[model samples]
Target chain A: MAAGAKLDPGKVRGEFPLLAGKRGKGRLVYLDSAATTQKPERVIAAEARFYRESNANVHRGLYDLAGRATEAYEGCRRRVAAFLGADPRGVVITRNATAALNLAALGSARLLGRGDEILVTVMEHHANLVPWIQVAKRTGAALKHIPLDRMGRLDLEALPGLLGPRTRIAALSAASNVLGTIPPLAEIARRAREAGALVVVDAAQAAGRLPLSFEKTGADLLAFSAHKCYGPMGLGFLVGKPEVLERLEPLETGGEMIEAVHMDRASWAEVPRRFEAGTPNVAAAAAFPPALDLLEEIGLDRVRRHEMELTEYALERLSSLEGLEILGPANPEERVGLVSFHDPLVHPHDLATFLDGEGVAVRAGHHCAQPLHRILGIPSSLRASFGIYTVKEDVDALVEGIGKARRYFQG
Target chain B: MNLDDLYRDVVMDHYKNPRGREPLERVDIHAEGANPSCGDEVGLDLQVEEGRILKVGVRGRGCAVSTASGSILAEMVEGLTLEEAGRVARRMKGALKGEVRPGEIDMGDLEALTGVRKFPVRIKCALLPWVTLLEALLEKEKET
Candidate 1:
């Protein structure tokens, strides 16, 4: 089920209960994987099974039950590390990608100060952008945007000029949620390294879809949520170099994060535990492996292949509609699995509502990228994103729905 | 609810040909409202004489429901006093949910928005205009 294997989407769709559409189900087409993927029946069962048999707090237990809980939780950490080809010692579990990115930002305070600059792309989702803005504000550092080209690719030519002596952190998204723009992270990482800046990646949208390697990319830190990667929510991780993990501050400073506490001061725990300050989402962590195992079996390369064909067809059909425009790169080779578009004759919200009525689910709005929207000069846009469960029929349904929505609104 | 019920022709009419969008030559009050989640923003300007709204003007960018809601509300409140407009604004929220008492309020053309009732997520869109109108009234109170 790994590389070069052809994935049968119908077979994959059957694995997801919601997508399988049991009794009273209609022609449900889900194209919002960028938001969150539909959990497979096995993934759901794994979570329920955890609660039924292994319901115990992780860490701080000598008994067998606690040992099982700790193993279940730590097992997930190892799996996530192996997924990204990173060191598990540096993986600190957080609530979600936003929390992981926030931890990365807040803890990177030592690397930023007055007159330093934080570089983020214009295509960043608010998850990656807002945190850096806060870091810049807190540290008196300047926040600058790496502008996008007309086709929505990051302007790499201007990056050298931007990566001057003051650049402390280059926060980049491995794949843009809205535009589906995948930047050359390793190249940017190399440049940032030469500039003596730490490279932080937001892979929330790319994790399960790309054959990503944290070590190979040479980025100091990377963050992604499990929910978007076919896993459950309430679980995310910050993967980084073990030494890099030590240098950052922990935003949460209580519970398990402490080593020894006095009335006046306390010592913090080592690496990841220093960052994970509380009892974690063990059930979700236990549930996550099945999802990752499924993707690993199907292969990220296969998933990428499947989504690309659907996306290529979607981009062609969507743009073929009268007055419709695609916001990002039209080439499937240039991006990942999503396509964001707008019809001049219909508002995105109206179109989205109309599409929902037709049983085709998509996301409509800035996709938490208001800055990218401003660059594109659109208030908002509609996005049809693909997942392992997506089929060619779904893309056809999306096209058909948009046509009907336009006629209804124009009438 | 059916899509037709939600996007009634009457509602779409206001969306396509919105009323009260031109800038008022004179203004007594102004307020800007934005629904951050949906990315809808509406600016309201009113010409009031002794509590009666003489003219209503609005500038907006959003979906048909929000634009139409703003247009419909601006037209209905044109000849009404501040207190009456306040009552209408307050009543529209209830009206969206079909919760109006038998003789309590005449929702009139606002009923076109009843289709939005089925979509709990879009309720905010239908209420955006009325919310802004209330904000404008509150600002007037601060001045007085």
Candidate 2:
């Protein structure tokens, strides 16, 4: 955390109250950031301060408090737009990444018909897959999956063949939650443009971990969640180019999205508000800026450096264990601070139970990516993900815990 | 929070070498259960003759607690009437929830699973087979 020094989680962990609990040194090692991140005390305090000092229902009241509340809510829109190098008017807030994907999918139904194609990558979380599947079912469009290579990376050569004349939309994840696979978006976006397909990116896993630029990625629409990025829960964003966002229709119809209201007929608001239908989560918006502050303080490049070191350390130690096979690329540079592995001799559920006794938390199960699990020919895998607060000792604890589980269960 | 409490020796033995794991050739009623939260699944087959359950075939893939619970249910339900099996299942469910003392009935090896009650998430793993067996009993008009 100091100038010209390595990241020290001993100092960084002090910012999180959960890690600062009754558990002593080496008693708890949380390795499940892919599921959800632990909130910092500052982010928690900002939300409490908003409710305690300035809290009001936004966009309806005409009082000074209402104006402050609206500014506090709209303030995050500007902050996020600036952070991602996007236009402020293009950001539409939602409950989570799934809501944003559903909104994008529902809007795409207008562009498709029978025989039309929706090209998607096979390395998607269900959040990115199910919505498009429902849209295909509704509009008679065919859902096409771009295949994966032997190492679980996207088969880039097949993209040209899959993106045909009728390819209306191309949906893909910026990074995979299960295999830790990160796709090359610029190349995919270039090919999608040749076939005239809209590119929708699910950045739920890649947002804060990587230095992301919406304009640079050439995506027409991008979505990400707040909770995964150390921001508050119950808030997410669906950002798009102004032209593309304007053409899409609102998924939910409610009070906040009206331009003019008649008993039987009503017009919609402008680009972003038309998509945001209901009353927004103002407290979470007020709390979100501090999370960005923490990310900026450490700097994304430093975060990347720290995570690469953590991943390499973890992959090396874990691969040395007998019968342990990692799911993704062996190189840490390809992954985004997470490693998923499986052992034939020990089930993930049983391993997770033993690890819990050692105070090491991990994710075990299909991770909401059942299709990927089925493709890999396994019921479940264990994931140990790192955050900015993760230190070398944490990875050592995980390796030790896994070694104990193998000895206890395999014998 | 002790691992020994949840992963007893008897539990691991059943997990390593499961019993009645092959699908039955003939069954009167069939039911399948899956814990989607953990992605564990199981299928049950009942061979009922007259009023008694002649056999319970178990097939599934999961952790020590789940496979052990299935193996225990498979061997424990043999030769009991469908009504008696259903009663035993309901009582076992109650016992895992810590709602009753399981000593009233002769639980046999099924008592090995009572420690699973301490882990709230794992209780589902220990109960999936028995619940599916109860479902099989109900489908053929056999319930207490």
Candidate 3:
């Protein structure tokens, strides 16, 4: 699937009400999809429909409402599992990607031994990095970070040496939220496997855009957020291999996740339910099927191509602007549909403010990756990330807005 | 809101050519404040003599709003009695929240920062240095 695979950017824009709404001067050119995507109509309607029609407790109750609600909720689980090419039994619903990462980290605690090393990269978002830090502190494990090359790609050459026998887990992000670098996951997974370390992939940035099959990906566990994929907020999932998940101790405990409860002790439920405790975000989970439907309708292969084309256009436009320095790889193929940059005369906050006035929404500051910014020797950078609805005209508007910002302060 | 309202020429002037953004050799009180959300930080170096701020020094790297606010704060607090400096910091904080305005007080160059009230998210940026100054004053008072 490529650019013209039955997916029209113009039509896609219309499907999102927020994207369709008019700004004072122009339409809202949302370039902050990396932060959180504007929800499509199908996803929005699916969530509202659940509340309006059948809202009941899932995994409990014998009434018809409960049955309907359970079907809708579990249906989404199966759909998402099939989409990621993982066993439905292994998919555990989460509040967001951060919760999933935390669960993965805490659950893996029993596997870690004193003096073991938890390997990660400097490019990881704080969500992926901090949890491992806590685990290392809790256990006697030592934490090490694989440094990024000057181009912001993981220093793969050093990864082999870093993943020694003492490494128990290698936590890495599938894509850099700041630099947009798509690290070679297969190679890293292979090295981690050879080093006898479990591989945890934070697919928060790469989930819907990339065609990821849990089996083919060679990762023992993967975590991602739904909001970043045009799905409703407050919903995400963690896909773990059954044997690997069985080794993880559940981070949460309460109703629904227990098989038997005594006065003092309890035997937990199976894998997915064991991790999910108490009342889940059922409405949001029900909406996830439609979100996956939207992705399937457009096809992930075409999504990849569409974003690559947009990234290429964005790179070319950004390169032409004076004083703008792009971070990460120069080639669009090496990254996703995002570009982060620093302007010599304009601070990212000032740049974002100016762009906001021009009706272009972009993210600024450290983007929750302060270590990467520190490594880059900058306080903050401006980022513009694309989505399915983004078009060439949107890139043009961004370029025009940058020109206005340059003249506003430096002129 | 217009970008000019937030990034006024005077604000840019202070940002481009900051004043007193260096470490004082003999500091009586030093306090650090950071807007962790944006990774912007402000460190204050104050030298007090006879219950007054003899000198004020500022250090940090941040956006135009933060850097300019720090510069204006460094210039404002020098040679003021500790109580008077506290009053100024309070007034600046009030101005950022729209509870006070430039004409309501003798805020001098800080009047240029009143526009920051419109950008709620950036109000913390404009007030980080002033907050640090207030903390340093409290620390100095505690030491005395």
Candidate 4:
């Protein structure tokens, strides 16, 4: 199948209300899906319908509305667990990936001690990195970063040397947000396990784009955000082994996350409920199933195949331009559904501004991975991240925009 | 959102051919400023002679807005008294704040960066070098 052919780009485009509106007399080519995927009308309507017709706090009242709300909320948990190929007892819904990672870090802090180390890759998002850093600082544990190779791929050969008796947890991203390189998680997890360390995978960039089976990956905990997967914002999941979840203390405590309350002390609820404190985003939770359904309808293998072709096509076209330096692996198979490049003649901000004028929306900046950018020896770069909905036409428009920018400057 | 507006002819020229691009190995005042938000950073070195900016040089990595802003500031500040440099910095700040027009900025190459006011996210990039210069000046002031 051709790129964007299996999925009707026009029909899919119409599903997003934002795309229906014109910004500057031009079609909106959203290349910043890595930042946040555009929500479909189905997802939006699902959320709105819940609020308009069935609005009630869950797990509180015995009325019909409350019963329906509680069922819907718990039903989302089961759907999310199945989506991650996780057991229902192991899934905990949080505000976002950042919150999920923090919950794991805070809960695991009890097991760590002074001089104990947490191994994380340099390519991790701040959400993953900062929490570990904070945990290390608070516990007097050491944090060691696994460096990437020249092509932005993780150096797994050095894993044996890095992992030691002091290594407690190894956190890594399934796919990099800036460079788009997908690390070899299965191999890394095996190495980490051999060293007696638990593996934490940040699947925020991989969940919807790739096949994510928590069981096969052999990770103790995996965190992912719904916003990046065309689902509603402020909803994400942390899939952990049952034993791992049982060991972690709840990061936040309040209404609904309790088993028994005495005058002075209280016992927390079960695995998923123990982690979810107070009221949750019921509408967002309700919207997730449809988003996953859309992905399922298109099939993830086809999505991956389509994105790879488009990204390869983009890389081939963008690299042909003068003074352009593409970051990350040169081959498409070594990376995910994105490309980050720097123009020697034009700053990324300038390139992005010109692209924006042409109705192309590519992200230009450090992309929240400043440390990795510094390691790569660039200040910032322009990133064109693709998704299931991206097409070859979008790549052509991007190339055209780059050409315009180069000509406007060099001419 | 016009790239031309942000990358004015003069700004691009300075970015292409920046003045004071070398390092001042024997500089007296040196400081670095980093904007962790967008990863724009600058290291500045200044030689103060009799309470005046006798010489200035900067080195770092950032966007065209930042590199050009540094070049423009470097070119305009040389030979000016420390007080005058402070005044110029204030005027540039006012320009960035939209308190003054690009035409009112009399600091030669400095006016090229007046277009940065249009891109709010890039204002920090344009100011990275100037902030480093300010910090260096303040540190020099304290020494005397």
Candidate 5:
């Protein structure tokens, strides 16, 4: 349905019931999709359907209910693999992006040796950054950084020096959660691979906003959360290459992942199951397919175009406002559909409160990238992000609310 | 979430022109407190003599509720006996938790931030500096 790309954002807003209503003094303008996306009714209905019609432990019982559950869960895995252009056998689902990233980090600890290095960037959200730090500490690997340039972009010029032979792994984010800066991952992945380092990309902010192909990016492992993509929470996935998957140790052990269990010892199941030990999030797994279906129906290329247009509009509007300093790249094309700004006259907390009074929702504080904020010389900032439902009116409302907040505080 | 209730004229004035936005030259106690969720931080420096606070100062970055409350706290604690300051800190905490009645603490400018009690999640912002000051005082007592 590529012809459906003609649908207007304002018209499609009705699909998300939360965006259809008014709050406080005006219509609710949700600009915090980077934090978590609003679930479509179909996605919510899918989860409820599984719980009501087919409720049973997957891969456990030989009965019809168990068979249905197993079929649905594994079917979603194939869908996710197809969506990412990855092999289904390599897809290991987890609780969320944090769990997925931790699985990659903790599971890949054996791959690193003493005096090796893990190259990272300062723009990573704690989920991506902290796990690598723990992995380095456990493996005697030194944690190194690809520092940001003057414009907050990753310093690719320094990549060659950082990705030397000692670099065992290079962990990077496809898009920064705070700055909205998308790194040149294909190039970075090439360098890491040439240096014989494994590449792990955190797609937490990039997955739904932009198109991603696991093979094309050349990442050995990738992690992303489903809740940020109009799906249910408590669901995320990590996909690794077959060879890399074979080397990863399972982070957890128990019920569902044992191949053969004596009273004393056991053998792990398969690649994905070995990593996923507990009872799977059966309903969540079944529900996640509808989100992919919706995205495919809308077409990801169209989604990216819609977001880029809005981001350009938002950047121009925010730039025209006095005292509002936008962070990240100067070009809207170089960033995602999110803008983090600092207003010299008003604190972010106060600005967010004032915006709430006007029925506008924006994220305040560090957005879990505290170190990035500190590097930018701000304690925290205000961020307004976009989704398929966002329209010109939302950005216009945010600009107006910001003007009011500045006036109220300065007066 | 009404802005008027949370940000009174007094609170805004203190925030815009904080009383003790600089560090004290010679202080007996010093401590730093941070609100990791919001990334608000405050550093408290106090010079105590015998059983009284001689001078107190606060400096750092944070929201209006926190910065204004911190400035007001510096003014209120100065020249007060350590015991009296402790009593005032307890009253402020009680008011923020909605456990104390009006006029119970007699905090003057500090009362402007009592509106934060309505927003339970933000009460920690208003309480950060005062709690940090108390921490310095307690540490000094332990040392002595």
Candidate 6:
């Protein structure tokens, strides 16, 4: 496919009903995809169909309705594994990326000890960082943070020095939410492996925007949220090697996960079922396949291409404005899907408010990466993130909005 | 309900050029207030003489609504009796809580921030400076 060719912006935009709604006598320009993607019609319909037709508890029921629900639920697991280039046996559905990371952290508590280290990058969302921090506090393990370079990308060169024999786990995001920089996961995984530390990759931002192959990425564990990938909320997946999962203890223990329960104790079921303690989000899980199909139909490569183009255009336009400082990688090639910038005279909240008045939606505040913000020496920034449905015109509107914000403050 | 009203020209002017930006020297009372949700912070200093209000100053960093509200408040409380300043603070609180409309605010400069009543998320930002003032006054009352 030609660059940005496969996805027809009009057709893709039509698939999202929220886009059709009127906003301030103009079309809604959604630039907050990094927070959560707007769901397509197919995904929404699939969720409705699940509730309308295939609504039943899985695994426990033996009736036709139950069997169908179980099949659909398990089928989603297989599709998610295939999407990440992993085996279905290794995939377990969780609430969201945060829960997935916590599952891994809590399960691995057995392996950690006092003075043992868990390393994470400064650019990690609290979802990835806080769990490890909690794990360290609980297990008496030392929490170490790998430093980010000036561009807000992790420095892989410093990995060796941070990793040691006591390093038990290394968690990092595949893409920085604020910077939009894709990190070198494979190299970091390799180094972590050499140090006998397991690598956990938070692909919440990377999954739908980029092509992710868990096998090739070399991460022992991977987590991503379906809501961020144009699917329904309350559904996410944790993918890992089967053997690694076998070593884990379930963070939650209840009906679905237990094979048999006695008065005293219980034996758990298999890998996925064991991890899924209670009723899974059946409707949301059923909704995921359609979202995956939609992404495949448009093609991820084309989606990435369109986003990169828009990001480059935004960077070029935004940087030219006086008093505007673009954060993250200056080179568009190093970033993906999003751009964050600061207007020295205007706080990000003011900018967001101004843009919201103009019918443009973006994110402000720490973007849940306070350490990175501190390192960048700014309180917060305004971020505009793009997705498959985004068009060049949307970037134009955003650029115009930024100009308006600057003028509003300056004049 | 239009949140843009919160960003009025008068509000922006105070935000851009806040009065009492400097600290009061030999300050009798100092107190800090922070909006944890958005990390907006403000520090207020008071130079009190007996029961009458002598001088009030504020220094802080935050969104326009916050800084402007701080400037308006610093200008309002100075030269008023301590009891009168307390009444103004109560009225400001009532305005923010939606108990009083923008027109009901008798304090001239403080009325500019009345637009903040619409944006619920920004209410805390607008109140951060006033919260610091209250803290400083309470601390001074205890000292005496």
- Best candidate, DockQ-wise? 5
Q: Is the docking of candidate 5 incorrect, acceptable, medium or high quality?
A: medium
Worst 10 contiguous positions by lDDT, candidate 4 chain A: A1-10
- Give the fraction of reference interface contacts each candidate recovers: 0.60, 0.63, 0.73, 0.67, 0.80, 0.27
Residue pairs in collision within model 4: none
**Candidate 1 C-alpha error for residue A10, in Å:** 1.3
Two-chain DockQ for model 2: 0.68
lDDT of every model, 2 decimals: 0.88, 0.87, 0.89, 0.85, 0.88, 0.85
Point out the worst 10-residue segment of candidate 2 chain B by lDDT.
B135-144
Name model 4 segments beyond 4 Å from true. Answer: A1-5, B22-26, B99-112
Candidates 1 and 4, the one with greater lDDT: 1
TM-score of 2: 0.95
Off by over 4 Å in 3: A1-7, B21-26, B99-104
TM-score of 4: 0.93
Per-candidate DockQ versus the true complex?
0.71, 0.68, 0.72, 0.55, 0.76, 0.47
Per-candidate alpha-carbon RMSD to the true structure: 1.7, 2.2, 1.8, 2.6, 1.5, 2.2
C-alpha RMSD in Å of predicted model 1 compared with the true structure: 1.7
Quick one: ranking by DockQ, best first? 5, 3, 1, 2, 4, 6
How far is A66's C-alpha from truth in model 2 (Å)?
1.3
Error of 5 at B62 (Å): 1.9
Candidate 5: the clashing residue pairs are: none
TM-score per model (chain B): 0.93, 0.92, 0.94, 0.91, 0.94, 0.90
Q: Write the residue-wise lDDT of candidate 4 on A1-411 in tens digits.
A: 354656555666777888778888577888999999999889999899889877899889899998878877788888888877889888888899999999989888898999999999999888889999999998999999888888878987788789999999999999999888988889889989988999999998888888779987879999998999999999988999988888887889888899999989999998878998899988888888899888877777777877788889999999789778998888888788999998878778777877888899999888888888888888889999988778789899999989987787667
Worst 10 residues of 6 chain A by lDDT: A1-10
**Candidates sorted on TM-score, descending:** 5, 1, 3, 2, 6, 4
